[model samples]
Structures are given as structure tokens and as C-alpha cells.
Target: MGGVSETHQMAPRPRRRRRPYRLAAALLVLLGLAGYYLVQNESTGGDGAPHCTVVAGGDAGGSYSMNLEQARYAATIAAVGTARKMPERAVTIAMATAMQESALRNLDHGDRDSLGLFQQRPSQGWGTPAQIMDPVYSAGIFYDRLKEDVPDYADLPLTVAAQKVQRSGFPDAYAKHEPDAALLAAAFTGRAPGALSCSGPLPQDTGDATRVKAELVKVFGSALAPKAGPPASRVAAQQAPADDSEVTLSVSGKDYQGPADQRRGWELANWTVAHAAELGVQRVSYGSKAWIAGKNKGRWIDKAPGKSGDGDPRNAGPDDVRIFVAPLNR
Candidate 1:
């Protein structure tokens, strides 16, 4: 028998050996791209929208930040608490709840038909989707429930108090946001002057006295009259600014009294601060303290003893909260 020719065919070498190198290179490219975007976002605030900072007690007590929309909602929440005469603690609880519920963004949707900043459920008697979507109305409802259901909420632990009003599946999640909420409350409630500020280019809208009055009515449910003017004068003042480059709104002390009055003043002042970007507010003065947008790096600075209201050399009295609005670009 001829030598049996048995040839063994070798299996083709697998191509798997090169795949790891290619994958590693691709991962490096992805990582580089991610890092580049992160840096860019940090530097320019991503989309160029204005940014707000809530500092706790003059930058020593830590801080938290959110975009313009979140800041606006937070201000509304605080304003509602003030309007309801709820204590700062109540505002803190509401803010913390909103922070956990929707990250302070008024949502048009939520878990199982829940909606708005508080994630209140329409199916559970919260409100119609339209009403719940209104920040002012929603905030009012939250305060009403908090007051009606948890009367002693101010004295209770934040989580416990919030859980009572929310009845959330993750009841304990609220606790994690207390620190941030407290900081925001301090600024929004006017417990901490100059505690909040917004930076970057102002919004495109140039706010005027009329817009200021309108916004005040929208949030506090009443028009804010000038301290020195009659109703007719107030109306005339709201018509248009003499300079057209600037406008001012004054809060009168006649309507408020005692410590609660002071709280309300701060609330209005802080509300102005919160809306500074949107309203084109250049400066806000209450008592002797003033917060100038983009001044001293957007911190509250002391106004001279006799200088307030656009450097008029007259005191902005304790009973008055004066807001000066200027062109955003200016």
C-alpha cells in the first residue's frame, strides 16, 4: 500500500486577537470626547442660559446651584410660603420635597399621572393637569396641605414632615435635599441677604415697571404698589419709564407690620433676586443692604448710609423694598 497520504488541515487563525486593541482605541476616543464636553459645559454653563447660586450664610455655609427655570420655581415656592404666612421651615420642607420629587423642574408628567414640581397626582385629587402645572397654584396647594395636614411641620424633622404631606413611595429621599433646601429657603425667605445670586448674560426680556407689577401679582396674588404713590400715581408710574433704560418698583410698609412684615420684605427682595435675570433687575435694596447683579461677584454689598434707589442719596427705609430694573444688556 502506497504510503497513506493523510494531510491535516490547520484551522484558520481567529481574528479575535485584534479586537481588543480596536476596542481600547475606541474607548479612549469616547473618553476624550466626554471630558471635552464636561469642561465646556462647566466653563460656559452649556447652553448659555443664566445660572443661579444659593449660598448658605455668605459662602461659608456651603451652597447649591440650579438653572434659571429651577430657580424661578424655587422662588415661587418660597413666595407661596410667605404669602400663606408659613414659616421658613415650611418653605424648606416644600423646596426639599420639590427637589426630590422633580428636581425643582415643574414636570408635565410623573409616576402614574403625577405632575408638577411636587409630583402631586391628579388622580388623587391634587388638581387638573393645567392647574398643577401652574407653579403659583401648585405651590399654594402644597402649603395648604402642609398647613392643614401637618400643622406642626415646622417643629418636626424635615423628612417626617415632608413624608406627611407627600406620602411618597420614597419618603426618606427628602432628607438628602434638606441642606440644599435650607440654603434656598434662607435666600428665598430673606433670612439670608445676598445669599442668592445669578450670573451669566441676562435673559433677552427687558423688564419694566408694568412687568414687575404683573409678576408680583402673579406670584403673590396682588399688585405691589409704590411706597410714595397714590393708586393713580402707581398706575401712571407703571405705564412707562422716563428713561426707558431703567425702571423701579417700591414695596410699601403700610400693608405689613412687625416681624412678619420684615419677613415679607425679605421675601419680596429675595424674590426679586431670584428673578433678577428674567426681570432685568439691576439692583435690589431693603434696609441698608443691597444686592447688585454682577457686582462684587453677585454678592450683597453694603449701600452707603444715605445712598439707595439708584444713588439718590436718600435712604431706602426699613419699610421699603426698592427694586431697580435696567436693560439686560446694560
Candidate 2:
């Protein structure tokens, strides 16, 4: 009681604690920002999420990039041209046209009755909706019209040729896609060997040999028809005395001749690689190079034809384009 009156400190005011809700709110804001960046990165292909690119001029030329879906349809468009014996230039024209019209999407909806890769209108006599929807069919008619209607389309300006076929309100739009389309045409037409590559995740289901063969034949015509032989094996094939892969596309040694034949082989081989993911193709090989799905699916493996070493699968015969499919998931 003796002059200690000022000692009433009131328990130090119980040091104010930080609120838990405020900390949670701050953490949530940080998480949301991180998630947004991750999505943006994936969308821009910062990771390997099934993308393709074409390098036309080795290192000197400009390159183009496309998602897997665009690559598949683009390959089909190129195959249709080549299958009809259309020149590489013709394929370039057709691809550019499709890129401008539909961005290579097999859309079921479009301007009026327009549909499919070419946005061909069934009402305009392109084909039935179902037919137009088929990439092979749409591409086939596009080339036919380009050839029959404009027999000298190759010599014309790329835009002029495309506009004649498309009759689009935006006629000049196609010309912008020509440089990229040409890169696609060269790789897909097999004129520029090993110029295209696709990398990404594998499908959950396995590849079907029959489906693979059918698509090849449909796209490349009779040149890719399977030879008369034993039925496809339940097991995969190798470079042994007997080629036992699911499908064998003989680039016809007897008929497949000259530089064109090599180009043909490369064309079919490149196409198989392009459709590998969709068709569940496990491996595709021609000449000395082979592409295997999964981790090494990004690039072609160089191995001697009719030989397998270094744990690599056997490549197709120098004259053959072989495709091996994965066994069914069942």
C-alpha cells in the first residue's frame, strides 16, 4: 500500500494473436494464382501435352506448330492429295484451304450447312453431312475439285487456287496459312523426310491393327494395302525371318521406284507416325528410321533395316513400311 499505485499493468493486454481466417485467405489467394499460371503454361505447351511441329527447311526455314488434332487431319488432307497422285503443291493448296476454313477441326457445325475439315457444305453438293464429316472424304473432294476445276492450280497463286475452291468471303485468309501449310505438305506428303514430329501422352486404350491398316489404305489409297499373308498375330512382331507386326505397308518394291518411291515410303511412314496416337500405333518404321510410341515417341530411332539392336525394335525392310500396334488393354 506504500506508493505502489502505478503497478497495475492489466496482464500485459494478452498480446493480440493473428486471426486464422486471414492466414487462410492469404494462402488461398496464393494457391489460386499458382493454379492460374499452371493452366496458362499448359495451354501454351510449356509441358509435353500432345503437340506437333513441322521443320521444313532444316534450320534455315521457318517452322510451324499444331496440336495433335490438327496434325492428324492435316496428315489426312495431305494423304488424300498424294493418294490421288496429286503433286506436293496441290497438297499445299488443300491444306492451306482447310486451315483457313476450319483451323483443321472436324467440326460438326459451321457457317450454314458447312461442316468438317474443309467446312464443305452438304447443301452445296460437297457431300452428305456424314461424308463431309469424314476427313478422308472431305479432303478427297477438295482435291478433286481443285484438280478438275482448276487443272493448272499448281501454277496459280496459292490464294487464287484456294479461293476458287472455297469461295470464302475471306479469300485472302488462306494465303496467310500457306507458309505453314507448305511445311505440313512437305512432311505429310513425304517430300521432306523426317520433317514432322509429335510428342505427348499415350492413349489409355491400345492400337488396333485393323484400324491402322484401314486408315492407311483410306488415306494413301492402294499403295498402303496389306499384302496376302498370315493373319495378324496376337503378339507383336519383330525383324526376324518372318515379319509379324499387325500391319505391313509394302511400298511395292516392284512398282515403288525412283525418288518418288522413297518419297512415298517416307510419306506413309510419316503419316503412320502422325496418326500413331489416335490409332494407338505402337511403332512405325521405314528405311533406316523407326518411331516407337511412349517415352521415345518424340523422335525417330535410326536402326538398320531388318535388324534390331540396342534394345530397339526392328525397323521395316528398306522397302517396307511396318506398323506395330499395342495389344488390347483387355
Candidate 3:
């Protein structure tokens, strides 16, 4: 009877399971807040924003601001156009098309299957998805098609020429972007020397001559080389001049010539300007104009005649594009 009097053990209480759910909800809220902060910072010129300036025709043409990504894409489009010998109008059309199609953002998806900067559709024979996704490749293809389909695309209205290539539902939309596109093209194509500049935190690994040369080759083709000095000899020297922070890119006459050579030189010069932040470029000088990254906040400054290179007297020729890479830690 005593043994049978043992009380039955009460069942253990169930543990509360709400803490994990609450923690997860809190985490989601934090993440959402972080995302909101990033968006706000981008829109409000925060440290994370890629501050960029595009001046249409040097100082007199005025300037506009675009995000770093847009500047890079615009530079690429201009490079492609220049390489193809396409006129400024061609670059304008291409840029405007990209602006309308993707707002200058290279997207992985688009209306139905469009892709890349121009949103060329794989289903429509633009190229494979992979090819279309490459900014350089897509740009080349766009220029090629424009040249083929509209031989006189340079003379046609921006919207009409772009529509010929794009065939978009809202063909008229491209016109609105023409003015901005022209500004971008002018800057990137080098018509406006020292007109394009970008400011931001430099990359951890910045100002490598090898890397700069490689990028030049990648964008402008392997045929790219210095126009005057021995390419390897000068680059291999790697000795900073009196400035203590300059790299001279003397383009070869064989590579650039004729009236177009001036534009080509500027194209390279402007490309350096666009990539200043990433490459630690402090100054880009071509012909009589120079863009100083720190001086006047990266505006193009006129160099007094015979002021370049300690009275070397030979005017800064059309083929010369001098890039002064910022010293490390500056």
C-alpha cells in the first residue's frame, strides 16, 4: 500500500518556442532597415555613392552628374563607338537606347527576355545570353548593327536611329535621353577633354601600370599601343618623373592618325578620366587641356602654352595621353 501511494509524476511543461520566431522577425527588420539605409545613401550622395561628373565640351559646355555605373557604361559605349569609327551621334544613339532600355544599368532580366545594357534579346538573335550580358560585346554588337542597318545613322535623328536598331514599343522614349546622352558622349569620346571625372574611394589595388595597359587593350583592342615612345621600354622603366606620381602614355602614330586621331586620343584620355577613382588617376592631360583630380575638384584646366614638360617645346601632340596616377596613400 505504501509503494502504491507514490504520486504520479506530473508531465513536464512544454518549452515556449516563440523566441526564435521573434529573433527571426527582428533580424528581418534589421535587414530591411539596412537595405533602406543603402538606398537612401545612394540617393542622398552618401559616401557609398559614386560621384561622377560629365562636362559636354570642356568647361563651357556645362556638367551633369551620373552614378558611377552609368558613367562606366557610357564610357564603354563610347569606346566601342570610337573603335568602330562611329560618329558622336552614333554614341548618342547607343547611349540613349541603353538609357531607355535599362537606365544604363546592365540587368540580367528585362521585359520578356531582354538582357544586358541595351536589353538585347537572346530570343531575337542578339546573341547568346552570355554574350549579350557582356557590356563590351553587347556594345560592339549594337554598333555593328547600327552601322549595318542604318548606314547614315549619324545623320538621322536620335530617336529614329535608335528605333531602327531597337524597335522598342515606346520608340519615342529614346529622344528624351538624347541631350544627356550627347553630353556623356562628348565627354567620353574625348571631344571634351578633362570633361569626365569620377571621385570615390580608390580600390585597394590601384595604380598598376600593367593593369591599366591591360584594360586599355581589353576595351580598345589588342592593337592599342603608345603612339610615340617604345611601349615596353617606357612602361618597363616605371620610373616616376619629377612629378613623383605620373605615368606617360605616349600613343604611337601608327595606332592613331588623321583628324580622327584627336578624338581617339581624347577617347583614351576620357576613359582614364572615367576610371580615375579606380585607377588612382589624379590627372589626365591631352593636347592643351588637363584634368586635375584634386585641383578645382577635378575640372579641366587650361595649361599655358609651353608649360608642359619643362620647356621641351614640342607641343603636347594629339597622340599623347598623360595619366598621372595618384601616389599610394594619397
Best by lDDT: 2
Q: How close is candidate 2 to the true structure, as a TM-score?
A: 0.79
Q: Give the range of the ten consecutive residues with the poorest summed lDDT in model 2.
A: 229-238
How displaced is residue 219 in candidate 3, in Å?
1.0
Over 30-68, each residue of candidate 1 has an lDDT whose tens digit, in order, gives: 999989766545433343335788777644679898987
Candidate with maximal TM-score: 2
Candidate 2 lDDT tens digits, 30-106? 99988976654443235445678788765758888888899899988988887788888999999999898889899
- Single out the weakest 10-residue window by summed lDDT for candidate 1: 230-239
Query: Local error of candidate 2 at 152, Å?
Result: 1.9
lDDT of 3 by residue, 84-130 (tens): 77788888899989989999889999999999999999999999999
TM-score of each: 0.73, 0.79, 0.71
**Model 1 ranges with Cα > 4 A deviation:** 1-49, 58-60, 203-205, 223-240, 243-262, 308-315, 328-330
RMSD, one per candidate, in order:
7.3, 6.8, 8.4
- Least accurate stretch of 10 residues (summed lDDT) in model 3? 229-238
Candidate 3, superposed: residue stretches over 4 Å from native = 1-49, 57-62, 202-205, 226-247, 252-261, 287-289, 292-295, 302-318, 326-330
lDDT of each: 0.74, 0.75, 0.73
